[model samples]
Target: MNLWSFLQDPASWVGPDGIGARIVEHLVYTGLSLLIATAVSVVLGVIVGHFRAGNLLVVGTSNAARAIPTLGLVVLVVTLLGTGITPVVLALTVLAIPPILNATSTGVREADPGAVHAARALGMTTWQVIWRVELPLATPLIVSGIRSATLQVVSTATVAALAASGGLGRLVVDGQRLGASGYPEMFAGAVLVAALAIVLDVALGSVVWGLRRRRSRIGRTAAELDSAPAAEATPA
Candidate 1:
């Protein structure tokens, strides 16, 4: 069947028990992997970003992780852990960590040194400087890292189907096994995966944009507060 025929076949993707359920399952797996990866990577990144010595270890580990090919890593995990969601989650989580850790560390390190220095000069504790000054400034970069990790996880999670965890990739693999006429089915699966990735990227981007806007508004408010006394003392 051609693309149009595939599109017209409602039963193919939307019946009571069809590709739709599998797609949802794929999304669930991807989401869970990303959530776990983000939590771990962000916390580790923050801790490493706060200290000079730890930063080296974080960067080195992140780089090493990124160097491991996704397919190879998936195969290795599957071999060790057996097939199903567990192996898939483990592989995807490993794939996601590097971007998050790198972005978070970069953001924290790039935060205004002057602000940090002033906080320390004021007798603020190390934790206080990190919590009150460094983290706020690093929010944008940290969010960007999350967005990157999320996109990676969504795309790669499809590989889970290869290990017997049903997903859009299952449709592709099964269709290919069925021969040339199965091209439409494979194409449909690819299109669905791409669409899902785009939607996720766009949604996460909007969230990051919202966060940046809030940060900007907060900065403006602080500026206005700083100028308020000067304005009041000036001639009316």
Candidate 2:
């Protein structure tokens, strides 16, 4: 069957082994990895960015993480931990950490220095400054990092099927196993994965855009207020 035929077949999208089920499995893997990676990355990034400490450590870890190949890491992890979701999650989480950590750290570090100073001038503690001033300013970059990490995880989660775990990758691997006759299914799997990535990217982009627009509006309002002449002091 051709790619269209494969996709059009009702059997392709229903039942236990159907595309729908596989997509769900793929999302599970992606979601779990992102949750763990985001939680860890955000905390570390906050500490590093807010205090301006751990720069070398974060840089080293991000570099090392980006250097590792995702599929190979998955295979190696499975070999040591035995094939299961745990190994898969661990590998994917590793794949996801660098982008989030870097984005978050950069965002936090680059937050408005004036705002930080003002927050401090108000006697807000370091933690308060981070929570109230730095993080909010850094939100755009942090969200961008999450968006990037999410896309990476979505694309790489297909490797989950390599561990005999069921996901959209199962179709591609199965098609490969079946030779020429399976080409349609393989193509279909690839298409679906690409579509999923595009959808997620657009969605995240909208969020980033909205955040920037809101920030811009706030900046404009603040600027206008600052520039506006104070009412002439009434004669005492």
Candidate 1, residue 41: the lDDT equals: 78
| lDDT tens per residue, model 2, 18-102 | 9999999988998899999999999999999878898999989898998998889998999999987899899999999999999
- Alpha-carbon TM-score of each model against the true structure: 0.86, 0.91
Query: Taking the candidates one at a time, how many backbone clashes does each contain?
Result: 0, 0
Task: In candidate 2, list every pair of residues with a backbone clash.
Answer: none
lDDT (Cα) of model 1: 0.80
Model 1: clashing residue pairs? none
Candidate 2 CA-lDDT value? 0.86
